[model samples]
Target: MATQPTMSEKRWLRALGATLWPSFLVAAGASIVFFANIDPETLRLDSLPGIEISRMSGYAIGFFMFWMVGLASSLLTLLLLNPTPERGPWH
Candidate 1:
């Protein structure tokens, strides 16, 4: 038997899903499209001179970078969508 999640836990899980799932999808598509036209080695050299990065590592890094961007966008969207709680009249 499994214990049911509390309301807070449920809300946390929902927020996580909302944030991660969409970002993951966006990252996947962005990685494919971006990497298709650009060479990671060239990108790495131009962006980070003197740093040696493997193609596989570059792909991973790119994917993660895209994911982070997506996460920020999603989080901002969530924050904007949430309504501000009412405060007592103070002018």
Candidate 2:
């Protein structure tokens, strides 16, 4: 049987994940937006979903969208890799 991880260990891993996800994902998102040179005006995205979004706001939203996707991926990974109760052969 494998031993359970300490509480501090779990917390440290979580903190590391939290810090890494936003930093990398958000930077990637911003880079994509900049390199793509997407013009919201041309796409008529200013009034998207009835909300007024400026050029700067568009980049901000892009960052948040990337963060959200990263968060989902991170959560899925954690859920899949997290330990579950082990069943003994007798049980």
Candidate 3:
């Protein structure tokens, strides 16, 4: 018979898997909304009413925000649902 996974191991696996796709979805959705609402001409620093930061900074901030949110959520879920230590198959 196969041994069952320990609670810690299961928590870790779930957290890692949960972090990927949801994060991507949020990031993509935000990007779409940002582009849709903002004027294209304002995207450039050399143009009138242009943003101060370079274009690369926007991408970096988006990526960082997505990753941080995903990671934090995953960890919080694991902590909240953490399993108590097993007392054999009896208890």
Candidate 4:
């Protein structure tokens, strides 16, 4: 047997899913499409010569960077969708 989640917990989980799931999917597709055209090794060598980063590591880093951007976009959209209360002293 398991206990049911409270309403707040459920809302939190829903918000988490809403934010992450779509972003993850978009990041996966973007990674494939972008990396297909651009070689990470060449990009890294051209951009950063001092650091030693492998091709696979570059892909991972790119994916995470895309994911972070997606997350920020998603969060901003969420914030905009939420209703703002009116500012007043009396209700």
The local distance difference test score of model 1 is: 0.87
lDDT of each: 0.87, 0.62, 0.62, 0.83
**Local accuracy of candidate 1 as per-residue lDDT tens digits, 4-61:** 9987788778878898999999999999999999999999889997888999999999
In the range 1-91, model 2's lDDT, one tens digit per residue, is 9888887777767756765676567668665865388765444454465666676766666667676667676666555554564631111
lDDT of 3 at 24: 70
lDDT tens readout by residue for model 4, 15-63: 7888898888889999999999999999988999899999989999999
- Model 3 backbone overlap count: 0
Better of 1 and 3 by lDDT: 1
Weakest lDDT window of 10 consecutive positions for candidate 1:
82-91
Clashing residue pairs in candidate 4 are none
**Pairs that clash in candidate 3:** none
**Among all windows of ten consecutive residues in candidate 2, which has the lowest summed lDDT?**
82-91
Lowest-lDDT window of 10 residues in candidate 4? Answer: 82-91
Which number leads on lDDT?
Answer: 1
Residue 22's lDDT within candidate 3 is: 73
Candidate 3 runs further than 4 Å off: 1-11, 39-52, 83-91
User: Arrange candidates by lDDT, highest first: which order?
Assistant: 1, 4, 2, 3
User: How does candidate 4 score on lDDT?
Assistant: 0.83
Give me the displacement of residue 31 in model 1, in angstroms.
0.4
TM-score of each: 0.86, 0.55, 0.48, 0.87
